[model samples]
Target: MGNHTEVTEFILVSFNGQPQMQIVFLLLFLLMYTITLVGNAGMILITSCDSQLNTPMYYFLKNLSFLDICYSSVITPKAMVSFATGDMAISYNGCATQMFFFSLFGTTEAFFLAVMAYDRFIAVCSPLLYHTIMSKKRCMCLVCISYFFGCVNCCTQTGFTFSLAFCGPTHVNHFFCDVPAVMKASCSDTFVNEMVLLVVCGLIIVTTAIIVLVSYIYIVTTILHIPSGKGRHKAFSTCTSHLMAVSLFFGTVFFMYAQPGAMSSPNQGKVVSIFYTVVIPMLNPIIYSLRNKEVKEALIRQLKRKGFETIMDNCSTASEFILVGFRDLPELQVTFFITFLVLYITTVMGNGGMIAVISADSQLHTPMYYFLKNLSFLDLCYSSAIAPKALVNFFEEKNIISYEGCVAQLMLFTIFVTTEGFLLAVMAYDRFMAICYPLLYPTKMSKKSCNRLVATSYACGCINGVIQTSVSFHLRFCNLSKINHFFCDVPAVMNAATTYTYLNEAVMFSLCNVIIAITTVVIFTSYTYILSTILKIQSAEGRRKAFSTCASHITAVTIFYGTVFFIYAQPAAMSSPAQSKIVSVFYTLVIPMLNPLIYSLRNKDVKAALKRTLGKKRLFSMNR
Candidate 1:
């Protein structure tokens, strides 16, 4: 309106003119676009067709897949057209439109993921009220809200940019009409618009991440109280996928947006964009689908059926549906199988022996002992759930677990896991009583007391199982039932659900915070008391002995809770996939193995028990 001349179009600059390079770009973009379309579209289609995926989480995922498709559509088509026609022209209005929608969808997806994290926190922390918290109507309302918020946010940016009158140059430096580039072309003052973009986008990113972080902090505290290695691992695994995705998306997005324009290069900016926009979307489907046992099984089932139909059409019989790509890698398969076999054997022997020793020894009868027993039991359940599938997948040419099997696995796993969290807190209290109230320890936490604590742990575990299984079972399963990890963790399972999950998230958030707060209070109080007692003791040896006993437990708790708190508590804007993967490995695989090793090696009583058992076995063999 300020200028007499009208700004109608903008010219986009292309990479250095080389016909070969252009052809390569054309072919590459075309292929990538196809994969993007097929992968995302297939997820939607499969989720729609599959009855098992009709839950709140899956419903969110379908929208996410569609969003990814939309995101890709915004950027890729323009690039493709540029490649094919060598016409790098985008009208001002066209550029503005693309930039707005792209920002809208991208930001929306981030918020949506944050919502998903809350869903997981609920499922893991509050097993009792998950249903009431995450009802269908509530989930739909959340999703609607998310979309409405996204539209409103995007429209604001678009309106601001569109209102700016372009009087000078009409050339966008990059392939698309990105916000920064569009602002660069404006003759009018755009500092306010840029500032607005930063403040609003930054706020959304920071807020979502903060929620996820708080949720995880509670989750880790709960996991630490678990006495068993397996149970803790199982609990951690359900969150692995979402944690990874959140980290990856937030990390790159943060790097791209948080910096000043002078600090960012077009090349580096493009690379950053590619990480969240392209690589992450592709990785999402693969990570959540291929790595998952249930999703793999579902895919295998679908493929087998398709294969049978193909054979029937060809007038031939279909005998077997073998996963074709890795059949020839026999040597690699054998080595992998053997490696896992040894690990599985060790896991079973080590965890089983711990359980047996805890149960058989009456001297070990206490609330602490019960917690250890639960931990060992959880370890066995978790290892069995993951190892066998992984082992089978390693050796057998095909890997699959039926839908019912997946649900059952997910259910039992959730039960043992949730129970482990509460058990850990109970164990902390027991420790506090033993250390702080040593004079009345026998009176306060007698054998009868231990039994009741044990009974309560199991009862709570059962209830947790029922709640998660019920919530999961009621959800509609879509065709996208592919899980991305070795086990049926909550997020992976949720990925295949077709219903809205906001209610699921709310329940999860409430439960996680409550459990975390309770356990943290008890544990913190106990530690404070124990520290005071140790300080007062004149005898150094006595203090050392007391401190030694708690050392291994404390270490195990710190490691378990530290990673969890870091992953879950950080803003989604701060984490990256690389960081997420590292954490997932820690909570799921490393911590489980470490838990048993620490208890066995560090605790003198446990070491003594093991030595006695081994010696007796050796003597019996000699006698024979």
Candidate 2:
């Protein structure tokens, strides 16, 4: 291959063969880029403005958000333009600049996440010494060191990548000048470049990953000894969001670059890049805000100080909405109605019974049952929000919902669902404390703390509901008002919009996934520690009992999240309206009913409480 010194500029062949998809790409990228800016900017603003968030954890979070903004801007704006205009050309110097900054920020973010893991470990594993260990001076030193290392790493890789003679085609088969894509364009023997790339990038990734892994190993071990279940839960919750962010960020980067050869096709590489660059930046703020109660509370306080009415005024919209429940299936209408009616009745009986049992029984009045009571209440609300309307719509020729009605349903449904997610996570934490930190359960899960946790769950749910409902209805529906699903869901309603739904979809996708991912992380993390503790127990019976205690909640979580991910996380093109409705029924109706049964049947305390209540009723009847 001959070196072409005259080629002053390289063309970025981004989505070149598919001209039809360019507009879609342009709109999507533009929306994502805008959100990336707003979310990261908001994170930084809130952290700076709030005094409560002045801890080491948030200090790193602030920097991470800033890094996300910078790295995302490197590729997103240019990619959006490339999609909008046909001008995909980039000067040699321009490409090098982009490559340098991209590497700089990307490497910095990776190191930052690892540093965050260390911060969390210190906080969870050594709370008394955390302030001393991660002092302001040390934190600043760490941040500066991260950037210094990032600069050195970026310069080393960028210099080598660009130094290669680009004698071959100047058309880079990527949205931006990524290290691999640019290297592929070099005409020289690039074995040394690939080796340098593999060795250097591999070391950075592995070293950071090892730091995180080691930190969590200690963190989990420390959490397991917390005498109170609440204490263990609180310690674990602090790191859940960070773990989620790390998994997403490092997982994608590892897949993209951690290979001896080109890992995948260019198209696949571009898709992976899109996630880490465009999607992850927009997600960091949401992940942190949703998982961190302090951040959420800070946001609420800030909003209240600015006047709640202003926020409400901006969010208020949607006069009426017609729910296209189950489409036109008159033949199965009666069957569907009967099926839903039975399911609804069963849900009420099950969840209602659980609530009644927990409230009446003195023996069941623990932190665990306190959360269970909230869970039951949320299940009742969640079911009522969807099931009644669904059953009514099954018989009606036209499934119509007033605008206010739709908004109300959406709000109630979102609140309960979101609250339930957090409630389940809280329950998992409670179990972890009970099993792992049995000695501290009473003090850690006091009445005051339990009440606070329940209150926070509901508050977080309301906040999530308001944001999701507002965003969904804010879109101009035009004439397309008929929702495909049986109830008003964010995705279904967003899909009904006649205008470009990319932004709406992006927001909805990011929000739902963040919530789901955070909750999942908390649950899994709690269990990871719980399982470790269980294995160490000397008695098999004790281990069995501990496992049994978590069985009901785990089952309930699996059924609920499995259905949710199937409905929301899946690509819209692959799922039909009918498929969505069927899955929705399982979660909305069937799971609520099953939850009480799973708890009651498997739980010794619940069964004992039920027997006592039945015995008293029989004795009263005999006296009568």
Candidate 3:
């Protein structure tokens, strides 16, 4: 017998040789892992909660999502921990267990995709029989069968691979323990093991590929036969997402494992393995959710559901959260405090002055100014929400905030920030109307309409705030009480929680992305038409005047969006606590102070209004 005692555990290759590169790899994989978890879990939740998505296709999609979660979880967490701790040792049993689970989930995913393709084929080719053929019971049975076969295949592979005698070098070149990697370390002949791996893997991959290919062939044929162009387009649209997903998943997988091992370098294998393992799972939900209008509408409906609102309303939590502002820079606390205090004072004066000026001047009473006023008010509130506590925290030895205080801060922050986003979108729409159809501007943007828009912005902000804050605090937070960043943000709080936060992270990710995306689309679409209209203006003076009116708004939008995206759009894992704090300072403190200056300095109207008000005050004082 081959000497098994010599090899009790295996050492995985270090992610990278350099320390900084290792940190980068850790962050990248952590981001991918978080995305995979959130996306797959969101897919499952969306499918289960939305009854309209109760079809065999979504049913299969749900199972596929679950499989992706399990598959990614099998390898990603261990890899992440390995990177984090620089510990690559995997005991014999641990390696075997990882191999078994990996094989099971991976094989199941392949089979599930093939089954999904078949489902699409039947739906497209024989719509009448789709319901009968892919019934709930039948769907469950197919899913179970996929698991059954996956288990059998995994057990066989795991047993055979482990049964081999690993004698000399127990170092696995790959990140995870797989058949090929393990077999590479075996002292005895691995011919039988290699043959079995080749045959089993090839059979599974080839069979699934054939099924998918044949299904698409018939699906395309049926789609092409449709009489109407719209019908054909509609029919093809359903399959496009699936096809893309299949192409992504199978392409990387086939490229990774289908060919003989010697043809590809280990580095190539690692890159491809990441694509299939981390990237594909993250992309699948996005592809499906984006392409399918049904999913989008369902998401909207879910957002508007009364139950969602009720969940937020019922949240009663602790009083305060300690705003841990810049704890990393103990020596720079006084400097930071002075700097933030100056920013805070400037922000209050700028926003407060704008609000006063707008309120006093009947000349500035228009839809645009109305939106500006709301935005200024929002900035004032937004700055106040985080700035004071942050300033206070800089001086305090132990920055402790009450439980209720934390929740309130979060709620207020969410409300104001969300409101600001909507207000900016409204301002963009206002500009679009003024520039695109000057004749209809008066009728389209009536005072009542302006009031309604402002009201809607606040209403939506409150609702969003309620939901986000409720969901965030609802999580169990036994692990750490200290907030990492300046204020009580969702990601920071979610990180502090001890419980499984995949659902919370997924919900937050979806909410933030959806809101930001919708508002961004509105702003961009409005600007598109506005820009086109501006270009068509005949007179040079008229075009110059039109551009001048929008210049301030554009500048403000750029500053706001650039900072927000830089901070929030990035993966939280990539952002160090100190980096997050610095970024937060810019958006929350500096941007608010800068916004009023940008508008007032760029616009002649605001400056003239200020001058006229001052002149009136001077005349009144002289008469007195």
Candidate 3 Cα outliers beyond 4 Å, as residue runs:
261-264, 307-624
Candidates, ranked, TM-score: 2, 3, 1
- List the candidates ranked by lDDT, beginning with the highest: 2, 3, 1
Clash number for each model? 48, 5, 12
Off by over 4 Å in 2: 1-5, 307-467, 470-624
- The models' CA-based lDDT, in order, is 0.66, 0.82, 0.80
485-549 in candidate 2: lDDT tens per residue?
88888778877754445545666677677667667766897799899999999999998988998
lDDT of 3 by residue, 248-282 (tens): 98888777667776324776777677778777887
Per-residue CA lDDT of model 1 for 29-85, tens digit only, reads 554455467567767876766666766667677788888899878988888788767
Candidate 1 deviation (Cα RMSD): 23.3
Assess candidate 3 and give its lDDT.
0.80
Cand. 2 Cα-lDDT? 0.82
Question: Cα RMSDs of all predictions?
Answer: 23.3, 21.2, 21.1
Candidate with better lDDT, 1 vs 3:
3
What is the TM-score (0 to 1) of candidate 1?
Answer: 0.49
